[model samples]
Target: MKIIRKSDPVNLRRTVDQGTVEQRKIVQSIIQDVKENGDQAVLSYTERFDGVKLVDYKVTSEEFEEAYDSLDGEYVQILKEAADNIRAFHEKQSTKSWFDTQSNGTILGQKITPIDAAGVYVPGGTAAYPSSVFMNIIPAQVAGVERIVMVTPPGKDGKVPAGVLLSAHILGVEDVYKVGGAQAVAALAYGTESIQAVDKITGPGNVFVALAKREVFGDVDIDMIAGPSEIAVLADDTAEAAEVAGDLLSQAEHDARSSSVLVTTSSSLAEQVQSEVEKQLADLPREEIARKSVEDYGMIILCETWDEAVDTINEIAPEHLEIITEDPFQELGKIKHAGAIFLGPYSSEPVGDYFAGPNHVLPTNGTARFSSPLNVDDFVKKSSVISYSAQAMKENADKIARFARLEGLEAHARAVEIRKERWKS
Candidate 1:
């Protein structure tokens, strides 16, 4: 792992922004082709990449039913439990459109409305993550989205993964398609003969998928361009190095681009955690991936004090921040920017990713400084509700007219003046 002293801020930015302009251009070309050709392009890309010829794009209801029946009871039950937790967590974030009216009579408030349709793109390469299904779908469900359309790439056998099917079944996702990659994104943005267009698309995927989403953003909204999994553990002498190491490795195993950094004030704890990461990584199934991640992007920055460590963390703006100190709750106030803050040693990144109510989909590549985790809010939009009685309009008309005239908006002033003369009498 790379070790740097606490003096550099620009170094962090340089380390994280690794993707090139050429990659983005290549993805852009693919997106445009799919947009133009529709299902033909989607099918061709699917056959080329996945090595499966798809006759049908959408997964039929019978397929979901058969998959649900075929799945093991144990795994199915886990999906249900996780979905329940996700639903509950996002339920709290659900809001209703409300209006307030005074006797003088102006009704002004905000109306929260769910989007018409939401698209969820679940990654099918590498492995099937049922957890991601729950995280992406439940929030839109909670927000009362009319329909949730899911897209996943099929395997060599021309079928989606059993876990992916089971997850779709558990969430009651009726519309699922076997299409994936930039073509799937294009299909979702501009409806094909089979797959319907969606208002917003959400989930994590490979670089091509992210780049496609970026291209289709104006045509359809997207959750975020997720870079890679990242975790920052803030530790001191009191924290357990093994737990810290495990947490760091958990993120590292996600992808080679994944970053895992440990910012600590205690030199002894930093040394212990580094040793522990090496020891634990040896036993990991994804050891090579984690090793490369640690070798390339990982860091153990020795801070002079806890306050300095916190400042460093804010600058890093990690996607996942774990407070593994003696009093983690006390340190919570110091953390200003992070996608999700895992408080205490027990609250690890996996907890939020799998079981915890919060959505695991988070901002990465230092975007935690601005972006946030996916939630019910992303599925819903607020519209300003304004109503004025004749008396109310008359009372406020002079003020409106005066302000408009001050801004040299003659038409704006005239509109209020036209209403004023009639309402005044």
Candidate 2:
């Protein structure tokens, strides 16, 4: 791993910018082809990339029923339980429009409306994460999105993973399409013959999917350009090395691009955690990927003070920040930028990923500085409501007209001027 002592800002930005341009171009082409050709283009790409020849792009009702029948009872129960957790958590974020009435009869408020439809893209790579299904759907459901459409690439045998189907069924997602990558995003952004265009798209995917979402953002609303998974541990001498290593490896096993960093002021604890990572990586199943991730992106920095360590963490703005110090609460207010903050030793990353009731879909690539974790707010939009009485309009008309005329917008000024005379009554 590249361990620098907090003086390599130049190399850091360069590393983040790597491969983004090429990725964007590739994703752009895929989106254009899908937008131009529609279902025919989708079928061609599906067959070429996923090796699944499909006469029908959408999953049939019979197939959904069969998927339900095929799943084990125990696993189905688990999916239901996870859905309940996600639903409960997101329900707290549901917001409603509110209005305030004043003596002057001016009605001012905000109206919160759920999106018409939502598209969720799930990855079909190394493994099927059913938790992602719950994470993506629960927010839209809480926001009262009318339709939830899911897209995932089929396996070589021309079928979606059983777990994916089970999760969708449990979440009550009716529309499921066997398409993936930028092509799937294109299908969602611009409707095909079978698939309906959606108001927004959410969920996490590989670099192609991330780049595709980035390209088609204006065409359709997206959750975020989710990059690789990451976890940063802020530990002190009182922390246990095994817990820190375990939390780091939890994200490291995600992909080779995944990063697991440790920022601490304890030298002996740093060495112990390093040894623990090596020991844990040896017995781990995804060691090859985790090792590459740890080697390329992982770091163990020893700082002179906890304040220095927290400052460095703020600069890095990692996706997941785990503080396993003597007093995690004392440092919580110091953390300004992080997708999710896990405090103390027991608060592990997987807890939030699975049953902790917090949305696991978070901002990556230092986007947490401005972006936010996915929530019900992502699926709902607010429209400002302005209603002025005749008298009120007459009172404010000249001010509005003058402001508009100041900007050289004669038509806008005239619109207010005309309304002023008409409402004078």
Residue-pair clashes per prediction, in order, are 0, 0
Clashing pairs in 2: none
RMSD of each: 1.8, 2.1
Q: On residues 1-425, what C-alpha lDDT tens digit does candidate 1 reach at each position?
A: 65567975536642334346997887787787877888888898999988999888789888887888888888788888988988988899878899999898889999999999999999988778788888899899889998899999898889888788888788888799998888888888988888778999999888788888888899899999888888999888888989989999999998888889999988888888889999998889989899999999899998887789999899889899999888999989989889999988789889988888888898888888888999999999999999988888877888998999999999998998897667446
Off by over 4 Å in 2: 1-4, 7-25, 422-425
Q: Rate the local accuracy (lDDT) of all candidates.
A: 0.87, 0.86
- Compared with the true structure, the alpha-carbon lDDT of candidate 1 equals 0.87
lDDT of 2 by residue, 344-401 (tens): 8899999999888889999888888888999999999999999887778878889998
Q: Give Cα distance to truth, residue 212, candidate 2, Å.
A: 1.6
Model 2 lDDT, residue 231, Cα: 87
